[model samples]
Target: MNDSHSAELLRYAAFTADPAGGNPAGVVLDATGLDAADQLAVAADLGYSETAFLTPAAAGGRAFAVRYFSPRAEVPFCGHATVAAAVALAERIGAGELLFETKAGPVPVLVEAGPDGVLAATLTSVEPHVEPVAAADLTEALAALGWSDGELDPAFPPRVAYAGARHLVLAAATRARLAELSYDFERLAALMTRLDLTTLQLVYRESEHVFHVRDPFPVGGVVEDPATGAAAAALGAYLREVHGVQEAELTLHQGEDLGRPGVLRVELRAGDPRIRVSGTAVPIGPRRG
Candidate 1:
């Protein structure tokens, strides 16, 4: 297919209303002809952490089949990409409910226009689960991150959490511990490759409902992610499972150290296992020729 008929590419910064903040993502409104290699090439050219490709499914249904690609490879699911796609669609087709058939599962997204006419998107993930981290793995990860066992928070132990993709959740004892993020990238990338991890979800709980987080995304060919929606969902699930947090709402502050501050909102229901991640997105600008 020719480029003209394939799809319209839109760029947006997700998880933050400001274009200067949050993670940027490329959204293909109708990727009916692009193959996997083409998608990868597009993602590589865009140079975003990840990009979303959307195609209409069989029948006249509104639900779409979505695929996510990083510069290096395809991921099972991507939260920021989903948010970007939702907002892009809303801008063109009007705000409403949308469904995405992803490699992990069906993700439901809600889109609306804010008071200032900015688009906001929210996605409810598939059932989330948490698993205990092996001691040896934790030790190796800590070593790679230059973090000692004593620096970890006793209340929040390390664990592997999954909303769509697996992430290692490590809580810091202090915010300073979270900010000092120099690490051996190659070593952490190798370890993440061995364990099939996407990113390391490092967090510091500021209060019962507020937290600060950073994501080391070595596996995605990026040193760090300014805003990570998938990891935020996984963290919400982990908190609910380990701490029995019955609260329905939580907030995450991220990307401050990177100078790109983004906020992610996580919602948990008492009976539902799915976690909801919400944020606003704004256009980055026109696509490159």
Candidate 2:
């Protein structure tokens, strides 16, 4: 790794304005000097759920070719890290629209200063879809999670949802079931690997518009992600497909159970299949990885 390039790493907490209340991600605004291996090494060393690497886009102005890395592998897209990188860039370049060319697809993000003077970013996900999970695979997931069929909410059925990345969506029958999350990590990781999944989006509906969520990300080498933007986008797509929620805004409360509370807003618009996720991010002090 180039010492000077490594020195430019910026740390930010995504999904919340408070530095201590969101998911921390490592961001390299200019990763033109780093190779794939170097980026992976940085992500592993930082030990965040994911890190963002940005290089000038071939398309030019306000566009970047972005890549995301978890400790274990590179992901096509990552929501929280994208938000972190965008907000970080906005602070330097001023808030506006930015285009990110990701492996998944081109994701457009908008950053603006809110009335309170905090910068927040909204990212429009690539076309999303939900598919049924194989019965055998669902059984294996439930076994690995130590959850029984009866504990699952019948209304929300098990499905694999994708926005920027794939996540298995499982709804708990009760909030308590969602809160107590002790699972067999190795077993779950093996299952996730076979399914090509990034995380298990465990959720409980609090109301028609409010929900609480948690993500077990053994595949990323994290027991639990404090806040997951990719999963939030996937969940929004899942709800729209399963429940016909054509046009409405949804509120998601995450990281609270882990003591790093953060909020994610999911917007579904009429006639648009894409999902939008919005959140605020704050800079956390510099760190080496």
Candidate 3:
């Protein structure tokens, strides 16, 4: 809450209209002058799972160069942060389309007005790719997570999926299994780091297109992330590409286990390879010292 960022920094809870719900994000609408360490300092001070910094893209015209940082490190992409930033921009500049040039690629985000002055954004991810997980690594992941192969859902299997960032998708056999989370933090973080993973997308299918998901984000220096849009995007691609669902709309319920409930809507088009993840955001006022 320094005076320098008094106007530059904005806090918001993304994926929910209520400020008390969703994942909190620190937003620097214009961080054109901040260096890597400066941005990291801002993010670490806020202590949100991730914070987004925006600077005008060199190409310009409603396009911005966006960077995302967790408390511990910089990431190639971050879904909830993107949604948070887009909504912040929309509120300031009025609802419309925006282009974000991320480290992963250029992502297009569409912002729209919602009921009773609420605003939401749907961001189309960079073309995604799904890859098979190494059996040994998967075994290590399960061991580190204190989960067993018998507890896994064979339907979904396991895969390393990427929409904007990478996530290891692991489906639990039941909702109960997904809810009971306890793991060796350092072990999992080491495994995730070696595999270049953003999170371990632990999930349980509630229905055909509805899922209950949780993300262990130790690599980001957090025990768990309440709402993870990047993992949601990765899951959408996993279902379509691996589960063989041609086109679908999926709903991911997250953060409820943490008492900060949030919802993320993920969509996939038949011909379009890009995954669209949508969610609402509400401002959380400014940070306090």
Candidate 4:
């Protein structure tokens, strides 16, 4: 990569104010000159689960065309990266509203300082939908993850959910079941690839409005995503649809299993099909691979 292109890369940890926590994402504030391959190469080099590349929109005031690239491929949308990019921009341009035109759709983001003086970004996802996972597909997924029907929560039936991207939502019957995450990586990757899934949203409900979650992101070439915004949004939709939770704010605790703990706040509003995910992101210094 060219030195100038490399110079444009900014690193941040999303979903947490602490640099050591959250999911780290690379953000290219100006990627007007970078092509798809260049963006992918940068993401792969950084070894982050995903990166955000932005180009000024044609009608440019506080608007940009954003694309997300994983280490191995381009994803339709990414929550943590979006939050990172938005916070990065807010730090420079001042907090406010920004619009991102993404592959999934137009995503509206709001950035503002929280009561604690930390900047937080909230992205409103495109209309989300939840669908059933075929019995055979669910069976394959269970086999790949080394989970059985008995291990799954009977209340939260297995389903494929979509906010900006698709994820298979599987709720564990117990917190212990969610903690031990040794799985067949290649086998899970194959199943996810066939199912066009981005990650497996493994979760255990700690309370009515609290959950502990983990995302296995083999499709993105990452063993796990420390904090997953997209899946959290999908989970909101799933809760609304299946659990009849019309309106409520839910807190998701993720990345704890990997020791990079972060928080994701999911808001579901009555009469609105879109999900809103909010989190704080902080810039991190350069790291060598």
Candidate 5:
């Protein structure tokens, strides 16, 4: 609306309506003149897990070119930031369809008001695929995480999955094992950097359709991400590959252990390579003060 408002970075907690919950993200609705260094500086100053910088696409209205940056580095894709940006746009221009030209690929987002009147955004990820993890690498990952090989669930196995961004998918045998997340930060960060991973998707299946998940995001300069949309999309594709599921709706509960509870809804449609991750976001208090 105003030049002053568009110039300031907007802060929102994605995947939940509560400002204190979910993964906080910085949304620069109009980063038209900001350079790479400027974007990085803004993200680092905000100190969130990640931030979204958007410029109106040359193609037309309702389309934008978006880039995601973590506190330390720029990422190819970021789910929570996308959620935050889409909702932010919807709030101003009415909820419906939006397109983002991302480094990973072109992503489509749908924003609509939920039953409770809060806006929710659904993002369809890029084509996703899964690859087997090498035995030595798996052992090294477990060591960095302070977890033993036996703690892993045999059913889920180990894999490097990619949706919008790459993530290492590791399923713990028990919920307790997943909760006690004390990892070697530097070691894990090195491993993630070498693998070009955005985060480690640590998961435990609560039921056939419900799961509890956490993300170790050392690369982002954050201990953990309360809700990880990219990881969720990767996990959804991983499940489809491992279990041969055609279509399903699964609920991922995250951030509860950290007292910032968040819910991410993952959907897989038969014959569709892209996974859809949906959640709500709420604006936080005055930012960059």
Candidate 6:
């Protein structure tokens, strides 16, 4: 590892209390001199879905402004990265409110130490909206995913859901169907590129308030995300809009197949269109360099 690689990288697993669970995120506490290319290189080297870069802010509110980068490219916003960044900041400054200016928009995150002294972080995304997926586009996506229309759940129709980033929401009729995730990566990546999609959110509803999800993030150069907070927020919005759930709190379980179990809490209020995702994060370890 070179000197640049030695630049402090904090690892955290977002959306889970255990380090072995949740989505792993690489966080650089001080990204003052790093350029876009350097950031991308670092993320690629880390081999995580996304890495967050923080630079000191001018207003002196939160210590730094944050940026997220996937292995292949820079995303507008990443919820897991946000959670990881917030938790990393909380470790140094104590838990409190953090305001982040992302490519998509401003995101507000609240961090606090739980009763058990574990750091918990909740991020409020930008206002979300649901749109109908074009029939032709759906056909292409289904073809790429090797899923037939019959396997889809009738209750949760296919739609493009956006909460900071766009994701196509698809519900499986059975949990077994959701577990088997074999898809054409190149084909799906091409389709997502054309559709401007971030990930394909595949879900199975266990109950009215409980769901299991898997996210195919081909665009981010990952076959499947172990845990995806952005897609979880989008899924919550889709459920609220289509199912008309009165209560705003919902639970999501993900990454079971990948063996990295994670839990995400989705909160939606009556008047608030923005979705809130809450989770606990634990540091993975010190940076390699």
lDDT of 2 at 167: 99
- C-alpha lDDT score of every prediction, in listed order: 0.91, 0.94, 0.91, 0.94, 0.93, 0.90
Model 1 lDDT tens row, 70-136: 8888999999999999998888788999999999999999998889888888999989999998999
Model 5 lDDT vs. the true structure?
A: 0.93
Tens digits of lDDT, candidate 3, 1-289: 2343443788989999889999998888888668888888878877999999999999888899999999999999999899999999998888999999999999999999877778989999999999999999999999999999999999898999999899999999999999899999999999999999999999999999899999999999989988998889899899998878878889999999888899999999999988999999999976442
Q: How far is candidate 1 from the true structure (C-alpha RMSD, Å)?
A: 1.7
Estimate, for each residue in 2-71, the C-alpha lDDT of model 4 and write its tens digit. 4435547899999998999999999998887788888898899889999999999887999999999999
Clashes of each: 0, 0, 0, 0, 0, 0
Candidate 1 deviant stretches above 4 angstroms: 1-7
Clashes of 4: 0
Q: Least lDDT summed over 10 consecutive residues: which range in candidate 1?
A: 1-10
Q: How much is 245 displaced in model 5, in angstroms?
A: 1.4
- What 10-residue stretch in candidate 6 is worst by lDDT? 1-10
State every prediction's TM-score relative to the real structure.
0.96, 0.97, 0.96, 0.97, 0.97, 0.96
RMSD of 6: 1.7
Q: What are the clashing pairs of model 5?
A: none
TM-score of candidate 4 versus the correct structure, residues matched by position: 0.97
Candidate 1 residue-wise lDDT at 20? 92
Error of 5 at 40 (Å): 0.5
lDDT of 5 at 24: 91
RMSD of each: 1.7, 1.3, 1.9, 1.6, 2.5, 1.7
